[model samples]
Target: MSGPLVSIIIPFYNDGYVNQAVASALAQTYPHIEVIVVDDGSTANQHLLDPYRSRIHYIGKANGGTASALNYGIRMATGEYIAWLSSDDIFYPHKVAGQLGHMLSRGALISSTDFDLIGAHGELLKPQLAVKFASAADFLRALHTFCPINGCTVMMHRSVIGRIGWFDESLRYTQDYDYWLRVILSGIDFHFVNSPLTAYRWHDKSGTSRYLDQVNAEFGIVHGRYVHGLNGLIARIGG
Candidate 1:
């Protein structure tokens, strides 16, 4: 059977590591895949994407932020499913194939896999984070404590945007977590694949490290909305 087309959207800003990021998307074992790279006003790194000009669909936009860039790319994408890949992270070759299979087998609209935390030079960090949720209460409990889904490790049906809309443009950080919260609250059930399908890069210069304060501040704002609305939400999340 033919698989649905999965658009791997990479919102490119920092030019330094985009090559590796794009390369991984192109290497996906899944055949029905399209790679879309959105250049978010990175003048210095624009040239780095020149080599892949003939391969991936590229979009050039002003420096709004990661959220805006991803929204733009999604708007321009023509695929049944959408997957976000960070410009600094690496998606394993089986990432798309594995997640896509999981979503299909489970009849799920969204799926996310476990990923490894790696250093700037690609050295593995200790203790890979794994996801397991037997019930909605379990998932909500995990979310109430910390984000269980990694943005790059997540794949959702494009139809979800019609329900939850785009990322919150106002947020400069933690938008992924915010988006996931919206997905969960919108009565959407997500499947978690235990396979490690991506590597999340952590470094001193990364956005999470450089803007740690802003990330924390935005995270507080994102989850706080749901915390107040958690009274009867567990049932909707279960299915």
Candidate 2:
């Protein structure tokens, strides 16, 4: 049977490693895939994308933020499923195939897999670097403190967008975290895949490393908005 088309959306800024990211998305072992790279008004390193212009769908927009870029790319996606990949990160060859298969088998609308941490030079800093929660309740409970789902490691069906809506453009740093909270509150449980299928790059230039204070501030804001709702969810889950 033919598999569904998965749109791998890459939200790019001025990151120099965008070429590698695009390559990885294009290299997915899953044959039915489309690579969409949304360039968020990148001033430099955009020339690197020229080589694959013919092979991938490319979008250029004003520099709003990652959330805006993601929303734009997702809106343009024609695939049944949406997957986000950062410009500096990479998807393993089987990332889509494995995760998509897991979602299909489990009848999941949204899912995320474990990921490895890679250094700036692409050295493996840690393997399968995800907190293994014993149950969905454990995962939801932990959300009150911090976000466990990596946006790049997540894949969701198009229906999820209809249900939970798009990422909050107002959130500069914690859009992914805010989105996950919304997903949970919408009564959709995230299906976890144990395989480390994506490489999360940790470097000085990464947003988390450079804007720690701002990110933390935004995290606090997002947490405040959803804490009550999520707490009730945890209570209902017997946490």
Candidate 3:
């Protein structure tokens, strides 16, 4: 089979640290990537992205949320495969190439890899393992316990996006988790790459980490929709 074209979608808002993220995607060893950076109504540090204007496809939109920005990128993308990267994260040089190779070989609809957690100073803090879900049921069962896939580490076929639909724009946090649940419920095949392919920065200033309660509430909504709700409970206890 021919190599697939991967669209890397990044959503940012007033992130002074966006340069590293953009540089990493631009530096990917995979030559078939199209980098799309969505500016989520960022007012401060707009100049931070000026250096990458020629290297990336930049889009400016109202600050609805990361989900809104990502949905916009998806609509504008023309790639056979799509991947998401956070503005605060950086991918290893060979991340795209390695993940793309695995997805093509396995014919995986959606795939993700392990990643390293880095501190604000760029020191390695911890290594996160990529959670593997054997089936849709397995994924639903683990939804409330932990996230089955890391959003930034995911690389999925275009068909998967069409089947699962777009990210939930209503979700300000845990949008990825909500999307993953929908994908799992649709019964798409998923896989995990054993190697660490990206660095997820953890700092006090990061949005998700700073507003953990909101994140938790959003996660609860997803779990309630899929597990604790009428349909979810029926799926679990009935079966």
Candidate 4:
């Protein structure tokens, strides 16, 4: 750990894959970083994390949704920037260095990279789908139909959190999409790096797979908050 402090916050439950998640963060090529793991009330498998006790800041909290766990970690983060990793996902070794460099070069408050999709056994699933937003207006336009950013691929400045505020605890499934939409809507630019910097695990046990119906329903509620608002935003940006 060598440059500016970057906080890698991993929120997990009883998933056995968590060790890989923390290991990926620990192996980041970036020199300076702090790894914080928030255990969201796991009933068992606590022993898996024992080996990393001295290597990370661990917090065990009562069973709450992912949104709650993330907010707790963000509040406790002491880094200039934050990088979130899912318990089952893996970050490319160059993830932090690559995204941080892009943010600094583009003067962006938040940035996300393209990512590869992997199977439960770490087998390649598919190449990354490209995500690009010319401006906030473009992002909002797309949100009318789909989420344009991957939450795990994000590396955002600490002040970006201050500007946009924390994740909405009320949003149980689509919280990340809701948060990203809010970030760009707050007049802070969101940038993208074309390089793939993370491996997105697509296992059946992943939240989306287990709660597809809930996520879809929650998306309706979340996107509604932007429908009328996006029209005004587009007008202001001359889009």
Candidate 5:
């Protein structure tokens, strides 16, 4: 019941797996936590949240992209730390505890961990699917090619928002990538924890699956903006 309060923000948008997501957040081994479910105009699945109405902070807003909904939830979060759990994702019971411990132990303001990939029915497709980095340079280099850090696996201090600013609302599909690039460019170390404490569901209905072309297009724009600078850093670190 005691520790720095952790805010688990869930951006809901008609995902059928939302209830399971909320259940996982509520089931965290770490007790000092608040789950904020931002309903971004979910027409069909809003009713699924009825059972959790009393436990979580449910905010209904006009349909917005994931970035917008996350920004809204961040604005409303009162915790010292924040973590995002996509409505279709699942957080292991030790997620908050493990990540927070890893961050605090190393004096890290922001951190992300390895994650498991799950099928639509929550069956494990791949365990520890995130590429592990042997050194900081490897991680930074990986960023130039792909987003090795999963948004759902990330946890950061509230001040990170103040430093890097919120997710770019203009970016519909690649907001998380844009935010990570900004954070890295701001000279903040993105500490990586080796454990997989989150399960990312890969379903056809998921945004990444349904809009692969758009995601790829947006990723190009976001990655191009940072590749030059990140390459410089990578060169320095590798040397």
Candidate 6:
């Protein structure tokens, strides 16, 4: 099969470190890739993105949260496959080539690869599995146990978005987790590449770390939306 067009969507809010992330996408070994950077009403260091303006498709909108930014990016995407990258994360050179090759070869709707955790100083912390689920049921079973999927490492077919709809704009956190639940429950096939293809950065100011309580609350909301009322509540509590 011919290679597919890959769309890399990034949502950022005043993240000065976004250059590395944008560079990662632009440097993908794969040639047919489009990089979309959505700035979520960030006023701090807006010039941080000026260097990449000519290389990437940039959008600036009011701060409506990551989900809203992502949804906007999705609507504007014209590729056969869509992937997301957090503003602080970095994709390895072959991330797009490897994940796209695997997804096309396997005819899978959703695919992800392992990634390395990077510290603020750009040191590798550890490697992590990119693929968290082998099937729909497995994903649902592990939903509350742990978040198996990583947003930045995921690459999925455009049809998956068509069927599952866009990310939940109402969620402040766990939006990707919520989207994964919807994808799996909708019976889409999931696949994985075991190689570490990206760098997931963990910093003091990162969204996941800065908003733990909000993240927990959003997690509960996702669980309730997918796992039914009583069972989902139990799972969230048990988790």
In terms of TM-score, the best-performing candidate is 2
**Would you give me the overall lDDT of model 3?**
0.85
TM-scores, all candidates, are: 0.93, 0.98, 0.91, 0.95, 0.97, 0.90
Candidates 2 and 3: which is better by lDDT? Answer: 2
List of clashing residue pairs for candidate 5? none
Question: How many backbone overlaps does candidate 5 show?
Answer: 0
> For each candidate, C-alpha RMSD in Å?
2.1, 0.8, 2.7, 1.6, 1.1, 3.9
Q: Tell me which residue pairs clash in candidate 4.
A: 1-31, 2-31, 2-32
Q: Which candidate is the best by lDDT?
A: 2
Off by over 4 Å in 4: 132-138
Candidate 1 residue spans exceeding 4 A from truth: 131-135, 235-239
Superposed Cα RMSD, model 6: 3.9
For candidate 6, the per-residue lDDT at 38 reads: 91
Candidate 2 local lDDT, residue 170: 99
Q: Give a tens-digit lDDT track for model 5, residues 1-239.
A: 47899999999999999999999999999999999999998888888888998999999899988999999999999999999999999999999999999998999999999999999999999999989877888778777767888999999999999999989999999999899989988899889888999999999899999999998988999998888888888887773
Question: What TM-score would you give candidate 3 relative to the actual structure?
Answer: 0.91
- Give the candidates in order of TM-score, highest first: 2, 5, 4, 1, 3, 6
lDDT of 4 by residue, 1-239 (tens): 35679999999899889998999999988989999999999987778889998999999999888999999999999999999999899999999999998888888878888999999999998878556666766766888888878899999889887778899998888889899878767777778889999999998888899999889999999888987777778888887
Worst 10 residues of 5 by lDDT: 230-239
Ranking by lDDT: 2, 5, 4, 1, 3, 6
Local lDDT at 88 for model 4: 92
Among all windows of 10 consecutive residues in model 4, the one with the lowest summed lDDT is: 129-138
lDDT of each: 0.86, 0.94, 0.85, 0.88, 0.93, 0.83
- Superposition TM-score, candidate 2 onto the true structure: 0.98
Q: Write the residue-wise lDDT of candidate 2 on 1-239 in tens digits.
A: 59899999999998999999999999988999999999999999999999999999999999999999999999999999999999999999999999999999989999999999999999999999988998878888889888899989999999999999999999999999999999989888788999999999999999999999999999999999988998898888798
Candidate 3's residue-wise lDDT over 122-193, tens digit each?
789987655655565565566667676789999988888778888999999888988887776666656778
Q: Return whichever of 2 and 4 wins on lDDT.
A: 2
